[model samples]
Target: MDLDCFKAYDIRGKVPEQLNPELAERIGRSYVEVTGARKVIVGYDIRLSSPEIAAALSEGLRTAGANVFDIGQCGTEQVYFATSHFGMDGGIMVTASHNPKDYNGMKMVGPDARPISSTNGLLAIREGCREPLGNARQPGELFQIDAMKPYIEHLLGYIDIDTLTPLNIVVNPGNGGAGEVIDALEPYLPFEFHRVHHTPDGNFPNGVPNPLLPENRTPTSMAVTASNAAMGIAWDGDFDRCFFFDEKGRFIEGYYIVGLLADQFLRKTGGGKVIHDPRLTWNTRELVQEAGGEPIESKTGHAFIKERMRDEDAIYGGEMSAHHYFRDFAYCDSGMIPWLLVAERLCQSGVSLSSLIDARIETFPASGEINRTVKDPEHILQGIERRYLEEALSVTHTDGLSMEFQRWRFNLRMSNTEPVIRLNVESRGDIELMKSFTRSLLDDIEELDGQSLRDPQLSVAL
Candidate 1:
């Protein structure tokens, strides 16, 4: 077994190469040994390779003396739901979340949907999988279950929509498993929906369903504009992250959605602690505080945020990456909840999504997020830290490297799963200053590479 398959967060790789039946079977046995769980729930996405991988994994689990509850063909959230809903000891979701079609991976959750990351139990699983210690003493049982309908019902319980006003809405499932869930929920939903690429085509004819990419969002934005819809939503591969487009067909930053959801949760929960990623706007912090709740910041990534939420007992946690986690939902992120709340908020306020986010935009201007490919991401990050961060700002390395100024802050960190360094800059309603600072930093980065940098202002305008 290749150790490289075990990523910083989950077990992921190219299908049949890095991820195959043999490797999945080994991981199954390893998971049983690491967690010492008798029964594990297994789920997978709509990818072409998912069925085979799920079977292989279950085979390994049964071989390791663990009964497997196979929840066939579902999103990552469904696996999380099943793990907690059925009181299973652990769960595994075979997916490649937002990655291209050629890739697939597994996300593991312990009891209560708590994630097992590299630093926690994933390393042990990796090491154990590398060396198989034979099969189980006896064959374990394998059973099948349909968790999607129940999962949809559970999501619907989070929001009240009895009197939701009908409005034109657009949804792009991006050819992922979300299409099936959306198909089931649309009839029950109170809206005129315009769907694009909603079909579950494993070929992903429309393109990869990752709305994080500017190119991937083009279809959703165009559809929203053409249909004159009130709002538009797009989901990633496993339906864990959802991206939004306003009525104007402009992509809304996930930070604003975080603040919106935080407000909604706070309204219902009577002001508790809210956990958020350190990447984007402090508007979420302000919103939480204004709602009489404590605001806590965590490192970027779902695992870290979920762990922090559990520790702080946060009512909810959100990241600018569009991953929203709820304490009521076993501290697991759900792509379904964010859009549901958006609809409810729109209905309650009788306002458009643009109108709702416009007020916050005035107070909290941001540069969105920027990803730059560099020869050495670390050297560029160190350069920025030594020159800009160490001298004038409060610095921290909770995720990669984050620095806060008096009124503006930015996080520059190499991606744990990719080679590029991700940059997120936010300012206090100063778009000009944000552009200047971003350009200056990019200029610094380009200087290190001896290449003339492009217009940073232009890069951010989009």
Candidate 2:
């Protein structure tokens, strides 16, 4: 087995070769051993290999003296729902998320659906997978359950049914796992959904199920425009994150969605704490403050955001990558809840989605996220820090290097999941300044790699 498959946040690697059934079973046993979980929840995405891997994991957990609550073929968040809502000791979702077809992985959570990442317990699980396991006193049980009804009920609880208005919306699951939930919730919602690539086909006829990619978004955008949709929502393979599009078929950055959602929650609760990732914070922070809510910054990633949310009792947390967390939902990120809340807010406010966040988008113009490949990402980061140290108001190494100046700020960080370094820049109401900073950062990155860093098409003007 390839030990390298064990990642810091979750286990994702090429299927069979790196994450075969045997290895998956071993991980299941290791999880039970490490978390001392008496009972666990397990689910799989629509991938062809997922069922076998999940079964192997179930075998591992069952043989290791733990009952397995199997919520068959599901999205990642469904496992979180089953684990926390049913009060399971732990949970596992066999999914590769938005990764390519060849890849498959698992995301785990402990009691209360809290993330079991590197700093918490994933490292221990990795080590435990290397050790031999003795036979258990008695094999545990496995139970099959349908989680959709309760899951849909819980999602609907986030919004008032009476407040919903009829609106045409486009939903693009990209033939992943979200279609199931959307179909389940259709009967209860007022919005007219225009679905594209809605089937749960593992073959991914339209391409990999990642809506974050520019190419993957075109179909959704076109469908929204054709259908005259008020908005559009797209999800990755395992449906852990959801992306948004506006009435004009324009893809809205998650940075602004974070701000919009923060305002929605703050207005309801009459002021509460909100958590947001550091990658794009100005809009969220400003909106939070304006809404009489406390803004808390957390390191990027679902694990960091969820833990921080629980600690701060944050009503909601958002990341620009599209992962959104709710305190009432066990402080776990959900792809389904975010769109639902946004839909409700849009319905109640009776304003175009574009109008809601347009001003904020203009006020704190961002470069979105620009990625660059480099031989050594750390060296470039160090170079940036040294160059900007004297001219900054402050510098933070929360998740990456965040340097703040009077009129502009930027965060340049190496991606944990990929070799590329990601840069996000925003200015205080200066679109030209944000663009200029983005260009300079890209040039510096290109100089380091001796190749053009900016991919013209991937770069978006906010």
Per-model C-alpha RMSD: 4.6, 4.6
List runs of model 2 lying over 4 Å from the truth.
417-419, 447-462
Best by lDDT: 2
Instruction: Tell me the tens digit of each residue's lDDT in model 1 across 1-462.
Output: 466878888988998889999999999999999999888999999889989999999999999999999988888999999999999999999999888898889999989888999888999999998784688779789999888778888988877878588889899989898888888888788789898988887788988888888899899999999999999999998998899999999999888999999998898789899998877747898999999899998988888899899899999999988899999889899998889988888888888899889888878888887888876666677667777755566888877778889878888888765668888887888878888888887888777534313433332232
| lDDT per residue (tens digit) for residues 45-160 in model 2 | 99889999999999999989999999999998899999988999999999998888888999999998988999989999998889998757998899998888999999989889
Clash tally, candidates in order: 0, 0
Poorest lDDT segment (10 consecutive residues) of candidate 2 = 453-462
lDDT of 1: 0.86
Candidate 2 C-alpha error for residue 59, in Å: 0.8
TM-score of candidate 2 versus the correct structure, residues matched by position? 0.94
